[model samples]
Target chain A: MNIYFFKISTLLYFLATMVYSVYLILLKDDLLRWASRTVLLGFVIHTLAFLSRYVEAGYTPVTNLHESLSFFAWMIIGVLLIAGLRYRIKMLGSFLTPIALILMLFALALPKEILPLAPVLRSFWHPFHVIFAFLGNAFFTLAFCCGVMYLIQEHQLKSKRMGAIGKRLPSLKVLDDLNYYSLKFGFPLLTLGIITGAVWAEYAWGRYWGWDPKETWSLITWFLYAALLHQRLTVGWRGRKAALMAILGFIAVLFTFLGVNLLLPGLHAYSNW
Target chain B: MKEKLNLGLKLNMEIIVIGLNHKTAPINIRERLAFQDSEIEEALRRIRSIPSIRETMILSTCNRVEIYATSKDIEKAVQELKQFLSEIHRFPLERFERNLYLLIGEEAVRHIFRVASSLDSMVVGEPQILGQIKEAYQRANESKASGVILHRLLHRAFHVAKRVRTETKISNHAVSVSSVAVELAQRIFGTLEDRVVFLVGAGEMIELAARHLVSGGVKKILVTNRTYERALTLAREFQGEAFPFGEMSVGLKKADIVISATNSPEPILTSEQMIRVMKERKHRPIFFIDIADPRDIEPEVGDLENVYLYNIDDLQKVALENLKDREKEAERAEGIVREEVERFVRWYQSLEVTPTIVALRKKFEEIRVRELEKMLSLHPELTEKERKSLEAMTSAIINKILHEPITHLKEKDEEAMADFYIDALQTLFQLPQSSEVAKEEEDARI
Candidate 1:
């Protein structure tokens, strides 16, 4: 049942992506409403799928490549829906829906069997760790979208070519503010995620500190975002510089989430496939 | 009966437009003819009193003075309107006669639609003409100078204008230098609310640019000039703060947007000064608009990481590009106007008494012939004379039943009352509507 709901949600997300693409080209308000509504519906069904999977697997489902990737996509869409309520940036979906769809497709291609929970993963802190980590990554995803928009708008202004694409984008100040908001929220969630992982590691492996690949990469990603936040607060590194830094930090996030898991060997390499 | 109905359609009242625009007349002549707001009611009343004119509206702006009216005699109406313009302005008819244009029938309708859509504007896609036209229309309506025809025509014109606005990109770009400057400021700063605008000198162009910024919601204005007294005078006019020339760097550090139009021979704001200000302001993106002749801000300042600089030539280039874009979009806008004109003309024709009466007669005749044939066929023993008598009797009864309503519909002297009667008759008898009339007209024309 959970798989069926997941498949249905993936299809709905695909529909949303197509709608958003049309909205971007036509710049129609009705199409944007349709796109946002479709995303909301898909998010609802996706949440049900997650809950159903938790019931079926008797555990939090972030234990493998497939489950974690799907969870990340779900969190991204959830964050986008929440952000949509706060900001009138309709074009954000045009940038975000594709990313979410690609993540869903990647998850769909991986293994789907409900394996038994490993002994090391049977701790109370595991679910909190995964949820905090994915939520932080979701916020960073929003920052990355805002960063890209800021660069495009800034370039359009600097070059003095206020064309259709430039007119459709939100102003530079709005994008920069969104980027700052994402950093302010994402950095703390990320810190808590790391702390929770450390506490869970001590319970599971009898050690709080480990030179694991995921751990080291996560630390590097955390430091990048921390530096960006600090500079944004003190030196007021904003506009183009802040946009570029946000982009760079998200790349670090992607590497820590995917690259380290796939390419490096570690105790946290639960995706045996 | 068919011939009479066709004649009625031919004698339908025509819409006539007569005017002189910027293209046709010089500013002196236009000024002479333009109607002030207080004088518009009197002008409309006098124009409506013309014997041949039925309903009227006057649109008077700096660029053009046009009178829109419906009349039975187009030529007489046109002559009277011209004579009224000459007499009211105390100008000789021969002086501006060559500048006048006379448009009648479908041409007049198309002209009004084009004007309302801004396709006929001095700047093709400027939005001011529509508001001016709406205000003129309101004044005419309030004075009761416009009746059914002008009312319907103006409303349709408004609809066409709205369609052109949304369906085309005609009005999306800012095509003036000051507007372009404001647009760039908005793109950099999002909302201009609480943003500070610093003026380097009290030049006309700089003052115009500052006025546009203030209207765009910039709350604070700072003025600086080589002479403190001049700066103080300009600042007081803007309800802002003035600074001495030596203190410009302080204003620059606090400002989000700066407009420099100094008469200095050399650049006053170099890259070094801007770099220090950027540090002091913490790199919160600042925009510089340099409209000065010798350029008050150095060109290298534009290359700074978060600094956006546009000079007079750069602003002009963007405005020119936007104007070209509007011209391209104007073609699409004209197509929309053409489509709407055809639609409005169709609706206008459908309200004619001839078509409705003709359709009603045709419907009654068809029903009478069908019933008579059924009765005659039922009695195969009936004589030829008997069948003819029955047909005549049915025709007489049908004509008696239709006579009162058709006469009342034709007797309506008010166009609005006539329209209501036609609409009620069409609904009561389920008459074939506008499409058939439009098709028949198209066939007749071909």
Candidate 2:
């Protein structure tokens, strides 16, 4: 049942991505509305899928590669829907929806069978750590999209070429503000996720500070965002510099989330696929 | 049958448009001929009071002055309207007569449509002409100077203008230098609200761009000029702060958008100076509009991380490009105007009493001829002369029977009543309905 719902939501997200792509080209308000509504519907069904998965597994669903990727995509869409309610940036979805769709597609390609939770994975801190970490990643994904848009728009303005794409993009101030907001929210969540992971590590392994590949990469990603946020608050770093940093920070996020597990043997790499 | 029907009676009342536009006249001549807003109602009344003119409306704008009227004699009405213009403005007839264009009937209708749709504007597809025309029409309506023909014609003109606006991209892009500046600024800042504008000189072009920004919702304006007094005066006008020319960099530091138009011989704001200012402003985006001939800002400032600089030539190029775009869309707008003109002409033709009368007579004549032919066949021995006499007698009888109602339909007085009579006669006699007329009648009812 959870698989069916997940497949349906992935299809809806695909449809929403296609609509947003056309909306970017046509620049029609009605198409944007339709795209946003489709995304909201997809997010709702995706939540249902997550809840069913949690029920079927009798635990949180971030236990393997498939469940984690799916949860990450779901978190991204959930953050996007909440952000949509707050901001009037119509073209943000045109950039962000495709990322979520790609993540869902990657999740769908992985194994779907539910398995019993391993004894070591069973802990109260595990779900809280995964949730906080994935939520942080989701907000960083938003910042990354805003950063890319800011670069395109800023380049167009700097070059004094008011092309079609430049006209559709939001202002530099708005994109920068969104980036800052994402950082403000994501940074705290990231700090919490790190703390919760440490607490869970003590219970699962025996030491609170293990320099496993995932743990080391997560620290590196944390330091990158920390430096960005520090500079933003101190020297008033914004516009191109800030946008570039946000984009760079998201790259570190991707590596910490996926790269550490795929290439390196880590204590967290229990996918066994 | 078509020719015979057309020859039954003449439709003497014709739509005549007489005017001079920017293309045909110099500004001096156009100004002399233009009707002031307060005097327009009087001018409309005076024109409508002419014996030949039945209904009239006058449209006078900065670019054109046009008189749209329905008249029995086009030549006489055109001559009188020209005379009226000379008398009202107290200008000599011979001076501006050559600039006048006289369009009659369908040509006049098409010209009015084109004008209302902004196709005939100096800057084609500018929206101000439509609003001007609507105001002119309202004055005509208020003064009771325009009757059925002008009323319907102006309504159709407004409709055509609306269609052109929606169905074409003619008015989408800004075509003037000042407007294009604002457009680029909006593209940069999204909304101009709470954004500060710095004006760095005192000139007409600078003032125009500043006014556009003010209307665009810029939060504050900072004025700096070579003469501190001039800066203070301009600043007072915009309700903004005034800074001496020496403090321009100070104003630049706070400004999100700067428009500089000074008569300086060399670049005033160099890249090195702007680079310093960029840091002071923390590299926030700043738009520089250099309207001066010798550029006020250095060309290299545009290369700065977040500074957008556009000189006079660059702004003109964008405006010219937008003009070219409007021209491309103007073709589609012209097609819309052409289609609407045809529809309006059909409705106008339906207003003519001659066509319906001719149709009614032809219907009677057809029946008369059919019955006469059957009788002649029965009386095979009848002579050719007798058949000719019989045909003449039947035609005479038909004319006698149709004379009263035809005359009533042809009545020039009370045009609204005439329209009613024409519709009723067409429906009562089951005459062939012009589809356009039917649609118009349905629209009228609605």
Candidate 3:
């Protein structure tokens, strides 16, 4: 919680991700391995930093958008590492690590001068709402990675620029399968997050759903991913088309988390940094 | 100079390739050499009977017949294979030797890689050769003729072939002998929609030839098989007619191009039969291609005017020409194979030194233990905790002492000093030495 270690780890994570991105371009799998190790090391340091913050603050770091987003990013890294380990996809960390580093940077940039969580945020629903939202978003983020890989691979196959990494990348079929399953896993968690957030709102603010910017954007994001899963299963849409739709849904999730929280006024505006 | 390590594993044994092809001794030789899927065990038995053959696998495709084997005595293996061929085909080996080409060591490795990658295939970059190689390996594996070295070499060759197909443009286009026939049809007839293709049999080769013609815009395909129902079904796919065996000559006259593949005891289409068709067409050149065993088209038809009688051998020549065009890409693929081969060989070499290194470490530990026991006897008055600490200190000291030497021995460059170190260590310790250990150490450096 020296916060300095987290900052340094975040910087290292950024550097590692960048190195891995270049490694992919250059086909340096050894360097990619090094980058993976570095990011995993950075995650360890980042975890220590977060634990220190939890001890200092004496509660779960989900009081405001800044704390929640920081935790959101930390959980995303955990999610990514787990997914990467399970799938044995090394290059994916190159993309997702940058997202984690950026989110952490944004966390550091938040006004740390403010006091702890307000009295209104002190509820059991608060932890559930934030935890579910962050985890659901993490799954969606992985779906996003699969989608991006799918599109790149599909385009390469179509235009036939299929160079080294293009050849090394998994087939469009595999990427589509990853995207489909990621969304399938993500949708219900997102629904739970939304339901919890709604209940928490009703308990604290005397309202269940206010159609606030964050709430509205979250619903839109939910609907998009929902439509994606629906269209894939019922309509038999898959491959590049499904990948593109999942990507679009993640973009909506991004807007709900970042863009709406920052750019628009809402009932949940107090949480914005 | 590196020490003489057990470089035998890395050593490329001669690939004793003894089998007839389209170019070599004709269909008679090739068919005689061809082993059926079930009869491969018998073929392996006959192959193993050949002197000095360490490993063997028969890859008999329609275009070429090849035997891949590892042999220390290349000449003896070749002679044995030659005798086997003579015994099987009942033809003198001297007649086919001129057409048979022998590749040893690196050339053999390169040839196998090319064959597996489809570069040596009748169709450049065709995927069928990979499957054929896999089938050959499977048969060899099941029969227990292939050894560990061959198993690794072949699997690595397959991996290399896959890498080439994925990383290069080697397999981007069709260049099969049948594909050339298709190409020629497209060039001459403009479109297959107006042209008629008369397929003379229900054989797979003839069906493939007909498929090429059909894809080339052949409007009508008249099929004449021994079985009229089978011919009718084939013709129906292309919206054409199925004529009876008796009406094959009539079907030939109707067909602008004829592709004949049959297993007849005698020539099905004679010069006299073709002469009548030539007179009916007023000397219109009928492109007749015979892709068959014993040849469905009469060889004497070449004497007749306005008759283009081309056989499987001739088509193979065209296929070879197409193969030549891809030699540049094949060279690039060869470079990849060479790199992978070296890497695999190096990895195998490293595996050899590991056991030796472990043994050497054990010897050092034995000496360390003896020294520790002597020290404990000298300091018997030391306290229990003090004695325990001394043991830890001594083990750490031994580890520190051995670390540098062990590290140096494990270095990639250690093969250069392998002989000197092994000899010096053997002399200093009065240890029993083996040439295999030194040879293994030398192989690891490369």
Candidate 4:
């Protein structure tokens, strides 16, 4: 029953994501609202399904790629729902729903593969490291959305199209502010995630830092976002420049999450479900 | 009253516009005819009592004084307007009415739109009038004097003006009509550099015209007003020379362009006066513009060869020609206005559906409660706590079921589906249409 609900919820998220993408192009606020509401509803159902899994499993519920990715998507949605409500930027859902859906779809495609943890894996700091790290990446993802909008708005303003969408989009100043704070919040959490990962690595493999592709790429993502925040705050280079940097950082995050696991063999890759 | 279906059931409604404009009256005449801001309330009271006048707006500007009104008896409103003008100025009614030109209905709406958009301005497509109209609308809105029809009309007029500015070439080339006149002068003379321009008055319009000419590279400006001090002040500001009124002929001879704007009622320059000046300049083509009312320059001066004399009327004709170019872009402007109008109308219509929705929700909740109560009464074996739990379960189920429909109704208010649903709810519940008001009052009491 739990599996069926998750599957249905994820499917609706995918459908809603597609509708939102179409709505961005269609430029209808009403259609966009429907898409966002649908996505939010899916998120709520997905959260319930995840809670049910946790109830049955009697742990933090992260054992393999399937569970981890599903949890990651859920965390992203939770952040989005909270931020969206607080900020009243319903438009962000159009950017985020697709990303959440894609991650969850990947989670679903790999079957139920909750591996029993080794005695070494069962530690106090393990869940905090993984969850906070993923949550930090969630913040970075939101920054990426704001960044993309900033670039589009800047381009449209330069071209003097000044369309309804151009007008409706948040100002460059607001987008810059969002990017700045998202990074400010995410970077420290990421540093903690990396630090905790390091501690976990030292405990499990007798090394605090490994230049593994995932770790290397995650560091690279960290540096890019850090540079963006520094440039924005120190040099006051914002708008399109900051946005491009954010986009690059988000791409690096994607590579760290998916690419390192799938293409490059890594210790984190435990997904032969 | 015969119904005029073509005018949207306004056959008995006569659109009477009684006013004095720059062309028909002098500044003294126009100022006397004008209504001060403080006097508008009393004027509105007086005008509304004048037998058949239904709606009225007093538009007072420096260049124009107009009373726009709809009346069952057109003569009554017209007579009142004339009498008010006479009483205010201590002039005869016959004298005041002679200077007023009346336009009705279609012409009136078009005129107001054009005036608000600056198309009907003394200098066509001048942007100042647009701001002035906005000020007038704001004042009217503040007073709560404007009704539904006037509100829509004024709102539409403002939208139309914005449309004209955005989608048309009217505001693209020239910002002011005076500047356009300068542009024409530049076209005629090839360049204003090393040319002497004579400003015959130190008035604001004359100052603006002189400034435009100076910016266009006129080498020298000769200022000659009736008052020597005024001419000297204008000359000192523009770094030009001041010629006394006695030496007007000398200034005319040296000037390649002569711009006259004064408050004088009599002809300042006659054909005889110009013929003498022309001989001294050896028939040099002098561009003459008399922006003053009541014939500052004799009309016959325009008939003189090598003298390009343009009075306010002639200048307006040029403006009309320019307006023809603006008319080409009117459809594009109307498209913008129509789109904005639809957007505002949709938002307004949505406001109407909100009460109906609230009523529907109340009716649904009532049904849910009644059904829950009946179900609990039938279950005798259930403990009080168990019955309470059942009630909670049933209530949650009811709320969850209603959620999608209520959300759908709120979000899809634009679709007219809400109206149908509202009507259905009213029919289904056999609820009174007045239930929303009563419910609100009842809630307030609670």
Candidate 5:
């Protein structure tokens, strides 16, 4: 039943991705609303599936490869839904929906089997760390989307080719501010996530910092974002530079989350599923 | 029969329009012929009194003063309209005769559709022409000058205008310098709602540009002129501050966008001066619009990292680009207007057809009734039930025989072919011109 929910959720994400792709080609009001609704429905089914897995496995369900990818996909949708409600930027869905769908599809390709929890995974700090990391990554994902929109809009403004395709993008200033906002909220959550992981590292491995592959990459990702935020806040660096930094920040985050766990060998990479 | 057919041909309704527009005449002549709002009702009243005119409407916009009317005598109607224009405006008829262009029938209908859709405007795809035509239609309707033909035609014009607007991108881009500035501001800032704009000089062009920016929702406005009192008055009108000309750099630092239209011979702000202001403002983006003929800002200022300076010629280039875009879109708008004209003409030609078919059937029924009465009197010995069946059989035969001809008359593709068919029917069956004859009767009674 839980797998059925996950399959349905993944199917909805696929359909929404198709609609959003069509919307990118030709912007329409109905297509956008339908895509958002599809994302929301997929989000609900995904939440239900996670809860069912938690009830059966007696854990938060982020301990496996499939769970981690699925959780990342869910967080992307959760953050998008909130941003979509607040910003109401119609074209944002046209960019982000495909990303969410591909993430979920890759998750579904992995084994769906829920294994017994490891003894070391049993700790209070573990859930907080994973939760905050997912939230931070989710916002960074949105900031990445805004950064792409900002560059496109800025190019349109500078080029003076005020035509149909140029009209589809949001204003450069709006996209820049949204990029700043996501970074502002996501940075603190990332800090809390890193702090929680450090506190939990002491409980599980008898160390405050392990210099593990995931840990080292996460610190690099954190520093990348710190530079981005600091340049934006202090130097008032904006437009092309701010947008490029957001894009780079998200790349580092992607490496920290997926590349470190799946490829590099480390203590934290043991639960590769 | 030939004489009666000639009478029916003379009674046929015709639509005609005679006017001089921007294309046909200079602005001086167009303004001279233009009608004031107060004079429209009186003009309509006098024009309707002309012997040949049946329905009349006048569209007197700045670009054109067109009189649209339907009548039986197209030549006489045109002559009457010409005389009416000359008499009312007291302008010599010979002076404007070369400028006036005349269209009749389907050509006139197409002209109206083009006008209503703004394709006939000086600036093609402008929206104001449609509104002006609507107001003219409303005035005609209220004055009871427009009748059946005009009511249908003007309503079709409005519908065509709506289709052109929704289906075409003709009005999508700004074509003027001031509007281009507003558009550029929107492209840069995403919105002008909370941005500050500073006016460097009080030239008329700058005021026009400032008006466009203010309406676009610029948060604050600062007016600076060499004459401080003039600046104060203009600022009071805009509900903004009148800053000192000595503190232009201070004003520039506070501004997000600046419009300069000064007549100054020397460059007001060079690239070096702007770089200093950029430092003071932490390198926030600034836009400069130099709309004066003698440019206000140094051209080198545009090379600054976050400063976008557009001179008058550059703005004109952008406006030209936008105009080209609109011209491309106008192809689609023209297609819409053509489609609408075809549909309206089809419906209008169909209007005359149904009446002709009905009148032909009426003529046939009259003959059948007369013959039936004569036969019934001759067969006085027959039973009532037999008489009823006989009458029904004759009626069915008449309906069957007349159906093909009626269908043939109603199915004509071209107006000329329809007229030929209508003329044939009137000659073969002598279908009386009921409406025209009734109008004559009313004329006699009055």
Candidate 6:
């Protein structure tokens, strides 16, 4: 039943993405309220489905590829709701919902059979490693969305084309600020996650740093964000460059979280697909 | 009383709007014609006393001053209102005649809807005109200068404005530079709702920017200027903290957004200062809006990561973009106004049958009650309960008898049919020709 609810929530999110897309296209203010509300409703049902999975698994739900993808989608939306309320950028959802919907769809398409919890994955440090990592990735995803919006809005302004999309998107300052905040929020959490993962690795595998593909990619993602933050601090590198870097950071996070688990053979690999 | 009520939706009734707007008149002329709130009641009273001007509403604003009145003769009402305008300001009619525009009947209604919808504003989609119109109507209503005609028209206009506001994209984005600055800050920080804004100058543009930030929900403000006294005064004005000019670096490090509009010969903030500030603040993103004429901040400051700097020219560019967006949305708003105008015209048509409906009901009640009383006198054996039931039965019968005709009369685009029903009801039932209804309404008003 919870899985069914999850599927339903994915469909709702897809529809919400469509609604926000239309709102962005038409610059319709009324559609924004409905779009946000639809996402909120989907988020609520998605939480129920996610929590139920935790109940069933007797652990954090993000154990495998399918669980990770779904959990990532869930966490991104959880952050989106909080950030959306904070930013009040209805147009941000237009860019964010599709990414979330795509993630949910990918998760739904993956294997549904519950994998038995591996003895290594059952360590207490596993939850900390997963939650902070997921949250960090979620913040990066927000940065990616805002970065995309910043580029679009900046292009619109520079190109002298104040079209519907340009008008709907928030200003560059707003996007950059949110982008910076996301990096700040996500980077530390990501560091904590990597540290926890190292501890968990040492406990289960007797090695703290194995140079596994997941660990390597996670380090790469961390470096990308570090560079982004460093450039931002030292040089005040904002606007398009910052936005692009934030987007790059998310791409790195995606590789670290999903690509490593799927294609690269490593100790961190939990699922074949 | 009969003359006052003559300006209904019935035949020969006309609504006339005589006004000077921003486009038609200079600011000097517009301001002269504008009515203060204290003067609105007296003006409405005086205008109502003008012959053929049965109802009057004066909408006075900085951008325009309009007089909306109703009469049986549009030309005479127009002349009276024009004369009133000329006489009140002691200006000759010919002097201001060239600056006034007049619309009669349906055109007047459409003009009102467009004005209420802000499509007719000097800056298209501005929000102040609707409130001004409402206040004008309120004054007219309090003075009893607005009877049924003005009441329906103004009420429908308010509704149309609301519809245009909600249903269209007329007032979605901020077009002003100060507002756009605030808007950009919001986009960057996610919200100014909890952010602290540092105002880095004491210029009019900077004051405007500070106001925008405060209104946008900035929780605290920091004011600094080259002159400490001015900074203290400006900070006191904003109810914010004032810091010494030398502490600007500290202020920059703490502030989320900095708006600089100071009169400086050269750039007040350079790239080096920003780098230090960014480092000190741990590289948190800070938004800088340099609205000063000579540009208070160095242009290269924007090149830094996490520093979003918008010079006045850049803000102007954004403002221009937003204005274009507003113009595009204004087209959509105009369509909404057109739709509302047509709807209101139909409603006005249906409204023509209302008096006859009222009279018809009154005639039926008179006959039913007379018969009921006569029957009770003839047969005193009728119980109070039975009498009450008979009253209910008669009222129900009358309602049922009138339902179909009333519904048919209220349908859209049936003005001629409404006239026909109105005349038939008046002639067949020998209903009083709305003069009695007018007197009754007037009596009720008293």
Clashes of each: 0, 0, 9, 0, 0, 15
List model 6 lDDT by residue over A202-221, tens digit each: 99999899998989999999
lDDT of 1 by residue, B75-120 (tens): 8888899999999889999999999999988899999999999999
Q: In model 3 chain A, where is the ten-residue run with the lowest total lDDT?
A: A155-164
- Per-model chain B TM-scores are 0.83, 0.79, 0.50, 0.44, 0.75, 0.71
Distance from true location, Cα of B285 in model 5, Å: 1.9
Clashes by residue pair, model 1: none
lDDT of 4 by residue, B207-268 (tens): 88888888888878889988999999999998889998989898988998889987888988
Give the chain B TM-score achieved by candidate 4.
0.44
Candidate 6 segments exceeding 4 Å error:
A51-61, A115-129, A150-206, A223-245, B1-10, B26-34, B86-95, B172-318, B351-446
Model 5: native contacts recovered, as a fraction:
0.45
Output the lDDT of residue A19, model 4. 85
lDDT minimum window of 10 residues, candidate 5 chain A: A156-165
Over A126-239, each residue of candidate 1 has an lDDT whose tens digit, in order, gives 889988998999999999999999999888888878777788888898999999998888999999999999999999999987979999999999999999988888998998
Which is the leading candidate under TM-score?
A: 1
The TM-score of the first chain in every model comes to 0.98, 0.98, 0.94, 0.91, 0.97, 0.96
Question: For model 5 chain B, where is the 10-residue window of minimal lDDT?
Answer: B1-10
**Displacement of the residue B383 alpha carbon in candidate 3, Å:** 48
- Give the higher-DockQ candidate: 3 or 4: 3
Model 2 lDDT tens row, B37-93: 889877877887888887888889999998888887778888888889899999999
Model 3: per-residue lDDT, tens digit, B217-324? 677788898988989888887788889988887887778788888789789988887777766664544667888888877788866643556687766765565566
In model 2, what lDDT does residue A195 have?
97
Q: What TM-score quantifies how close candidate 1 is to the native fold?
A: 0.90
Worst 10 residues of 6 chain A by lDDT: A155-164
Candidates 4 and 6: which is better by TM-score? 6
Cα displacement (angstroms), candidate 2, residue B241, comes to 3.9
Candidate 5 wrong stretches, greater than 4 Å:
A1-61, A122-125, A206-208, B1-11, B38-42, B90-92, B224-239, B242-246, B261-273, B292-300, B354-446
Alpha-carbon local distance difference test for all models? 0.87, 0.85, 0.72, 0.71, 0.83, 0.81
lDDT of 1 at A78: 89
TM-score of each: 0.90, 0.81, 0.50, 0.51, 0.81, 0.72
Please tell me how candidate 2 rates in CAPRI terms. acceptable
User: What docking class should model 4 receive?
Assistant: incorrect
